[model samples]
Target: MRYHRLTPAAAVLAVLTLSATACSTKSGTGTDTAGSDGVKTGPGVTETTITLGALTDLTGPYASLGRSIVNAQQLYADQLNASGGVCGRTVRITVKDHGYDVQKAVTAFTETEPNVAALSQVVGSPVVSSLQQEIEAKHLLTLPMAWASSLLGNEYLQVIGSTYDIDMVNGVEFVVRKAKLKPGDKIGHVYFEGEFGENALAGAKYAAKQHRLSIVEQKIKPTDQDLTAQVTALKQAGVKAVLISAGPKQTAALVGTAAAQGFAVPVLSNSPGFAPQLLATPVAPAVEKQLHVVSPAPSFSSDIPAIQKLAKDYKAKYPKALLDSGVIGGWNAIAVLGEDLKAACKAKDLTRDGIAAAHRKQSGLSILGVSHDFSDRAKPSTYESFVHKPSKQAAGGLVNVEPAHAVPAARSYPLPKS
Candidate 1:
């Protein structure tokens, strides 16, 4: 759980590895030759070309989500490059689409062999689960989009925000507190199968026990586009409220079904199930009033200086884009990468190990209004140790959530009525 800051020499090697391993698909080769000053310098080095790659779902079930994320990451990269690049090094991102399939994700990762110092925004649990071993073996640090809690224990993987478990627990607790729900309140949970669902379910169960709430119903599946059956099941059970752990499509379906069935209890969802773009779609106007989403970072409407700057720049470049979790999540991941790159370059080494070491020494750095000290020896139980905001719909169908809460991992919330 404790991370030791890398020594000067170690930092140098990490940067060196990062520069060398970034994108030599055929064989690992250093693009820059190191000089006596300990900086790698060559045509590539002088150009400050750092080859980075992203594993995105540009053409599959998650393509809509993936495209926004890729765009946001591109925006971040462009901004960084325009501002003299990270640590005086230019960053080039090579994005590969895995179609949200585990096998395809493995293929994408394999294709990136001998290249790509780090992986970002991978979309699904199956893909991440497949790549876990390779990531560890290569010491490739992963910034994941999937929020399954199981990924937290991996040393090579550092999630940028809250895990699904933390989000669910926090969400349930918040609703319970706000609703003034007491012990024995009936809570229902609906989720997809796999790690994502299990994590949320685990968190809900924990919270229910902690708060002495009764879980009246639990419905799960591998994938369901229609939630009529689940909603019917929950209604029959007479649950007080429902906690959902699902992707956008399913989440929308559940809300629609719940509304149609006249089940008006409050609904809480984890990060995966919440998307601002969903609000713009046909589903938004109807579900906006009844649904509440927990976000790991500041809301898109957040007035934080950094978040505002990001939003302004994002809109100026991509005028038609809607600011969603995918966009913000991708932006945040790339920002972390940029910060680590800056620190590594300051150390004059651009290797994987060096970057990881730099990350360890980065203390008190703020991102998206959340401050974290990676330098700490204590391993965080939940990445949500930083502040989290619950997003709700604003006037004109836009997201108008404020940054009002700072729930630590130590805090526990009551369970939603089952």
Candidate 2:
């Protein structure tokens, strides 16, 4: 596993405080009651403290992404607590650093068992895969950051955003339609070798087929410092478009290399490939002129009421850090968790069973503009999973392309040729 030392100042602060509460239970009428089996019996929970855990990459290679999510989760928790919490009870979040390692993620899961009612924001695909069985065995509901299609059928996991493959397809389709590219247009892809990369490649292939275009070249690797070779390959193939599905560092390298090679094809990126820091790096000027990214939410600079409020509050609290999409996604995840807890605590008995039951019955909960209605039939569905595109706005801001779309399932798009 890769290790990156976390500056002590970047450490997360944990706030834990307990409050005593008492309330009379409604008599009879099939109300919930505590049973010998440790399950609460009732219509649902009334007031109860629910402990949620976040295993994030607070001090690892994905630190930038993970830290923003941690801050957003805390912000949501603070907002909920300020509003009297859910169902008269307070919600507490326990955060642990997985260091972006699969093994450490497993260890973090074991360590957090005591307070883990649900796990939110598990940051990497390998880590999520490692914990899949454990999560199901413990009956722990999980909200994952990784978007591998392998996670699609899991009963214990609820993916809350567009998966990698879907994002690529939507992004490519939008660019093709908007650019009016015709058949025989050549497209290229540069991606990593694992699930993250494969998912993007799959989407590109699918889109190419649907539009009767061709993938002129494909470059795959496990890791690289410079993508000069990949860029050279794409350039030689005479491709008119390129799709990249790598992390921020590699993405920066690709953009810089592509620019240096004088390859100016329209470049589309997966979610992580669009980190603001990457755009702010020295290579940003070139990227700004040539890069386009598919976003899962409105751009960070959107004036939409929800984003505006979040940005204002975040800046007020963390003046040094620029608000980014990952942070907003984290906030959304926590908001949904708060809503689930709220629904769970509406009954007389505040217990695990009651909370789960409440979540199972959730309907019409809104977060920002997205509406989530989970029922017994949709127990593992996520609250926000649509695909959005972020383009530069005239006033020096990023905004989502109008008419954002969603892919309800992995197969929603045509499968790529093997």
Best by lDDT: 1
Per-candidate local distance difference test: 0.65, 0.64
Candidate 2 lDDT over residue span 1-418, tens digit each:
1111222343444331212122233312223466443435332222355557788887677776776777778778778878887655556667777877888888877766545456657888888878888776655567787766567655456666555777776777766865578998888888888878887788778878878888765555545767888889889888888888887677778888888888876777777776655544677777776777775556655556887788888777666665676677788777776766666555543444444456556567666655655453222243133333333332122445543465443336643321
User: Which sections of candidate 2 miss by over 4 Å?
Assistant: 1-11, 14-48, 216-222, 347-357, 360-363, 373-397, 406-411, 414-418
For candidate 1, the TM-score is 0.84
Q: Per-candidate TM vs. native?
A: 0.84, 0.83
Q: Let me know the TM-score candidate 2 reaches against the reference structure.
A: 0.83
lDDT computed for candidate 2: 0.64
Expressed as tens digits, the lDDT of each residue in 1-418 for candidate 1 is 0001112333222322232234332333334456455764322233347667678775676766776677778788777889998656678666777878788888877776456656656777788888888777766657777766677556566666666676766676777875678998878888777787877788778777777887755566646778888889889887778888777677778888888778887887776676655665666644675677665666666567887888788778766556666667788788887787788788876666566667778677777777655563233323452223233443112343434343543254332221
List of clashing residue pairs for candidate 2? 32-41, 32-42, 33-41, 44-347, 45-345, 45-347, 46-347
Worst 10 residues of 1 by lDDT: 1-10
